[model samples]
Target: MIEDRPYTGLFVLDAGQGVAGPCCGMLLAATGAEVVKLEPPEGDWSRGLSVRKGPESVLHAAWNRGKQGLVLDLKDPAGRAAAQALAARADVLIESFRPGVAARLGLGPEDTGPDAICLSISGFGQTGPYAERPCTDAVAQAFGGLAALNQGADGIPHKTGPFVTDVMTGFAAFAAVQTALAARAQDRAAGRPPRRRVLDLSLLAGTAMLLASQIGEAALLGHSPGVPNVPAGCYQGSDGLWLMVTLVRDPDFVTLCRVLGLPPLAEDARFANFAARSTHAAELVPMVRDAFAGQPRDHWIAALQAARMMTTPVNSPVDWLADPHVVAVGAAPASVQGALGAVPFPAVPGQPQPRGAAPLLGEHTAEILSRLAPVPG
Candidate 1:
């Protein structure tokens, strides 16, 4: 219902593959930017990632909604020239090539107009010793300390199931591009000389940002610390359903124990406070698990809510879709129609839902290319 179209006349050229850069472009498009997604001849590699309905993958559909697609084989001279031209004319240009590839193709920030905002997303960074190193979401998670924090009960570090690092990097790039655009507009309004903005972002840096607090704690402690709150995790209920319970205040633990009818555990010296409970987590967690297992998930959830304790059923994706609150709030308000047929999507927070499906591979290529000036030899 929110008509948040602020970038009506802005032109965005998205020359990135995978999740991060496309996510940035998608967000820009949600704000009414005219985003042109430029891909290689085989198409954005994401199109073949998984669950492809012909040329459309779920990953591609999710991130690339509300954009026009243009396929160009940049290995060819004409393709490179066309991309450079698009980059030169764009208000914002996003690319995820290796450190120097964009520069070689003449699509770098230096090649663009002075007022352009160019965002370069990579595995490491644009100028580091690891600049050319290849990376993926899993790689970033492993290298950026998230895997360590995500260590399972079996003591094995695990990458998250979703593409978390790439998504976070996309959000970071989106914020950076918006900031640059705002700055450009302010300078223009003040009658100052226009300046080009080049943003260098990376999946590795984004993962670090995601684990900022954990990294800070590790630095301060000189060693890895245990989980801050003991027994504050998912527990299986009597009905064979799982629910997550978390405590922020020390008093909440006491309240939780009382709610679960384990007053003795609350009174135990070893579990007196958060620090004590964390120190004795090995002994305390199993008891808490046993207590939670004595009641159905709904019963515990109700009792905990009544006691002002933080808890909720660990809803699966289907459960989330059918949740009353999620439905009432219209969390996923848009249903995009495509080869997948009416796939529901959550609206971008504080922005309008995208008005179109992911553009087909080169859907508007001929129309868009016809409008461009002929490339000179």
Candidate 2:
């Protein structure tokens, strides 16, 4: 078993309620940080997301594990004071409000400890002209050119289902926080005062960076490869299930044809090279799809594996839960106890156990406030 390293008791002040900021806090907490999630008296907006038992919703539980919860009305003077007190002692502060909101609350980087690292995640950025505009993940993706790459053959753009911008921003914020922490540690070792830093992490910027390939194509070739590169999509298997294939090399294309029992495709001029394969993808994909459709998913999967061609069936939640490899790697556990009953939550990667369910709202409020109270003289 891999030994788990406990977080060295770094404090995190999570003032943001939604996916972006909370996800950052959650990652920190997973590494053993003491994350204090401050929500309004009514609770974080996500807490009321579903009719789950108590104040914990499915979304809230998934994003807020390993963190303590506190309720404070930021609009109230007392609430603001409590928040500032927490911020002063915190090592990291993550907020995802519109630009200027944290500053107005007096909880911005300048208002916190000099050593504190502040991560301000927003739709645009702090200094951008559109910083104050309210935006969602889809809007950010569109603004960042991700939606442009998602256009279909019809040339109409479509939104990706998941909130990619928010998720990517969360990951970026976590990285920035870790970098700040490392820098602060170095400063302390050198006997210099730890410098406070404010990271302006924009969802739009994060999404744009994630589209490096698309951006590079436009810059170098003067045109964007609108959809996924050819030979990198779902293909039909003989047994009616879909198998996704990604052939990055001409050799892999050869192996792909061999796996399908077609040797002539590799010799054909149109499908000979990667560039040619891409140009003739319309012709090649139908052939490959039709060949795959001739066999069952398992037979093709085995054949692809035998040829060392990258492949997998289109996996659903059910497929993942029942997969032998997933079970062997402990990706999905047997069951999880929730307020409703025992439900299955996927296992943690490289860990023996899945994380516990999120704590009840304000479950530790009394104990935490008591610890913070001044000692009697």
Candidate 3:
């Protein structure tokens, strides 16, 4: 077990139930914060959404590691009061309910103690025109223009395979909280009262900001370039193995050609420059594909790397688990017994692997409440 540090004793009030808010709380907890996951009496909606064996659902494990759990019926007056009381002493409050939900429940930032940082994560921002409406990760992705840029075959826009919006919003919320903490520390050092702040993080806004490069291209030019515009795409080798290549500059293009045993494509009149290569991508891509198809994936990967070209093998999860680099880096640690029996989990970066399991529902309710109650004089 790793020794705990002083002053990192942050309390996280996770009023949010889904991936976005819980993910933010999890990151804080992993880094040695005292995170208290506040769940409703009926538990989070995510707990029963899909394939769940028990409290050990994949989603739950992925989002609630290293955190304590507490269940309170926020709809009840006593429950709401208890949550508000906890928030009054917390360093950070993360809520992902629709706009105005926390305020209605009497848990808004204004009701919290001085110097508290409130992070509000939502589909839209707290003050947007559509803030009152409910939305999901897919909805936010579509609304954020990312769907348009992620179009698949037949020109039909598609949602990303994973919950991209939720994940991005979680990362944004964590960043906002850290910034607020830094500001508060500065204030304390200056002999001033700690400054309280509210972060209004929206899934749509976070995802849009992430697409800044694509958006900028579209704003300056008539359209964003297509995926196969340059020597950057997956190619099938002759052995039926696939290799991913990314050539960004003239040197990269030359290196790609050298690796493929072809004359420098960058020196050719028809494919000499970015513009020319883009125009001739249809011809160039197939040539590269056919050349790569003549060799095994490992051979081409080595050849390309030797030429200083960027390349990677497209691998599935099984391949990733057995990869040499993954083993060398010790990404996956040995199975450990928690509330749920022995389970394999990834190790924390720069930290020893946590041996504790996720908390059962309300596992720390009695202990936490005892600490929160005032002592009689």
Candidate 4:
């Protein structure tokens, strides 16, 4: 099946660690490329990133799955020779070292030749005032102003769970590479000489791009985006289950009031218009909350949904994983036999079921080195 893939003939050398760089290689492998993950004698630090099972960690296994693993300490002269040799033969080379590290190791554009595409993933990109600063997912979020979008009622912001910035950079890198390669292909076919291009992406830029809408609202409207002037917010039901409700159009308030058995709210002079309802939100919210507190969440969800109001339970991750809609979508398995027992992968549109499990540290070192060995005359 891999042999018949879109990138069957492509070769990718992944020298990056953790989520961003490995994710880029994982994406390439999914499309049928032969991806060789270059690691050191100590292995990728991500091997210890999550709980371990035997020789592999779930996080390491999930992200590094579907690639051949090769261990070479580029800090050593011999290791650098092997790394440069591999880079010289690769179609694509991806790294996440600090700005100048790859060039110092001889794996940069000059070494990869004019046809190879080199993608550099960093926290603040290769050229910036903060280029030398070390950054991780949380650091990028805070610096990129992504945390501002996740503020609570107290106005205190929070970094999101897991590697949001790192993962976004991976998605961005994939798209950028495809665009660059397509343009290169066109250029070469038109008789223009091929030139090696270095693609630079930063977690800062990727995370900022994801916050475009929220930032736009803050910049253009002088306020953060929010549900404007309506009876809308999360409320606790009788069973203590939380659900969100929204009144979008003016008529939605009428529908909501009728559903909650408070039909008079629609015509009450004190709460007649959107402005009145907003002004009296503190007064109105409790009435709605009390009405819901008399019933289980499902009852309100059903009634509000039937009335065409936007309402939904604030489902937990576990609830969403078992949701009927999620099952019907069918992109992910309930669980996979990962290096660390049965681990789950996130549901992504069009992601091929992992064709291979994660490789052990230096697992394919012998296999890869033999392939790169010089030919005998």
Candidate 5:
């Protein structure tokens, strides 16, 4: 068993709700932090998502595992007091409430112990016109300029189905927390205050940062170019499955031509080089697509591999779970359970599995609160 616990002995207060903040907490707990997920008396809203087995939803269970569950309604004075007490004792506190809500509730960074790392996560960040707006994953995608990039040309902007921006924000928060921890440590060694070591992060910023390359390309080129060259997208194989083939260089085009049995294209002057092939892509791509229609997906995949060209069947999520490669990789969950379950929880490269079951709503509140008795100074 690979036991990964770099953040061992670290206590984390997860006061955020929904995907991004909760995901941040999950990543932290997975890295060996003792995370306490503070939710409302009812439950975290994510518990209402995906397929549910009893009180637990797969989405909620998956992210909340390896953490103690505590319920506190910040709207209630007593609840707010409990939250403050927890924050005072925590090594880190994570909150995703709207801009000023945390401060109003008396659980904001300024309210926490000077050394506690308070990470505030939001859709647009802690300031700006959109900061206070109610934001979702799709909203962030559109606001961050990423939704406009789902495709090119046809004059339609589409939002990605996955909560890509949300997940990205979570990852950004994870990295920020680690960095903050390191910074605070260094500052303390230098006899500086730890409170000066961190700042909040936003989903919009994280998503936009991911577009650095694309934004640069758009600026330099001045026109949207879908994919370079031709036959570089999804196509239907004879077996009726979609396959993607990318031809980055001239030799790749030559190999693709040979595998598709369009040997003429390999020598054709109109398709001689990348620029020529791209210019005549409309003519060559359709012909190549037609050729691929003559062979099953496996036949083309094998032939393309044999020819040393790039080709792969585009798989749906279910298909991916059943894929031989995916199964061999331990990518999919062995089985979804409330806790780490019997399966090895999938982790980021080099990170070990953090183990714990998703607690029932407020399941640990009494125990957590009971254990919070004043420490002898």
Candidate 6:
């Protein structure tokens, strides 16, 4: 556990469902904020997503760790009143509703008082043609140009297997919240009243941020760069394990050729330099591929390292979990929740590992709501 708990006294109202907003709230919880996850009567939709055990599902565990739960049906007047009361006292409020849904429920930033920081996460953004349209990670990837840039060996653009865009949006939202918190703190120190801060983040915006360089290249260069490096891709060995190889300079290509026992190809005019190799890639790459096919991945890995070339085995999730370096660094730490058992999650690079399991539906409702009750005369 990290000893630095900066947000120890801060209260965060997390009225977000699914992944993006929950992820930011989870980070706040890890940093010692008192986060209350506001779910509907059926609980957060993520609780029913995949592999549910009791009140928690894999999605909930992955994104809602370390937060308390409050079940509130926004459509119900009483429930909406309870949420509004909580938001009024909150230091930060996070929601993932479509454009005007939060305002309709009276939980929008304008309703959360003047000093509260509000973060709204959505598919496109708050004011856009698609603001009201629903979207998911897959939709964001396809619509935000990520799929277009992630071309596969088969020449088909494929959305990543994981929910990368949603996670990216979460990270972006977290950063924005931190910035707002810092600014608010500065205002307090300077003896000035802080105004309300509203942050709008979207999956499409996050995807665009992730592909910033690619977007710049497309617009500035007016065409794709097409394969930045020749022969620097995945190659399958005889053992059927794929290894990724990369060459940064002309000498690295020489080293790769030497490692593959194709020293003559390094001197051959047709494949001598980066330009030549790129031009003749259709011919030269096959020769390198055939050479890699002659040996197991382990053999090529050894030879490539011995020659001081950049290379690594293409790792699956299982392989990553068992990787020696990952183990040494404690990259993925397991959090044990009763009944749910131990769940391994990647540790945030500079942040503390989350301390608790996701809360059960409305787990802290009674205790939390009682605090919001009016004082007796």
User: By lDDT, who's the top model here?
Assistant: 1
Question: Using TM-score as the measure, what is the rank order of every candidate, best first?
Answer: 1, 6, 5, 2, 3, 4
At residue 321, give the lDDT of candidate 5.
73
**Which candidate, 1 or 6, has the higher lDDT?**
1
Off by over 4 Å in 3: 1-7, 49-51, 227-229, 264-267, 334-355, 374-377
Query: Poorest 10 consecutive residues of model 6 by lDDT?
Result: 221-230
lDDT values for all models? 0.90, 0.77, 0.78, 0.82, 0.80, 0.89
Cα displacement (Å) at residue 281, model 2:
2.0
Q: Of the candidates numbered 5 and 6, which has the greater TM-score value?
A: 6
Superior candidate under lDDT, 3 versus 5: 5
Candidate 5 positional error at 292, Å: 1.8
What is the Cα-based TM-score of model 3?
0.89
Kindly provide the TM-score of model 2 when superposed on the true structure, using C-alpha atoms: 0.89
Ordered from best to worst lDDT, the candidate numbers read 1, 6, 4, 5, 3, 2
Model 1 CA deviation exceeding 4 Å by range: 374-377
TM-score of each: 0.97, 0.89, 0.89, 0.88, 0.90, 0.95
Per-residue lDDT tens digits for candidate 2, residues 84-176, read: 777888888888888888977767887789889999988888886898888778888888888887877588987787677887888778778
State the lDDT at 343 in candidate 5.
Answer: 38
Question: Per-residue lDDT of 69-159 in model 4, one digit per residue for the tens?
Answer: 8889888898899899889988899999999999899788888967788999988989969999999999889887778767866889999
- Alpha-carbon RMSD, each predicted model: 1.9, 2.8, 2.8, 3.0, 2.8, 1.7
Top TM-score model: 1
- Candidates 2 and 6, the one with greater TM-score: 6
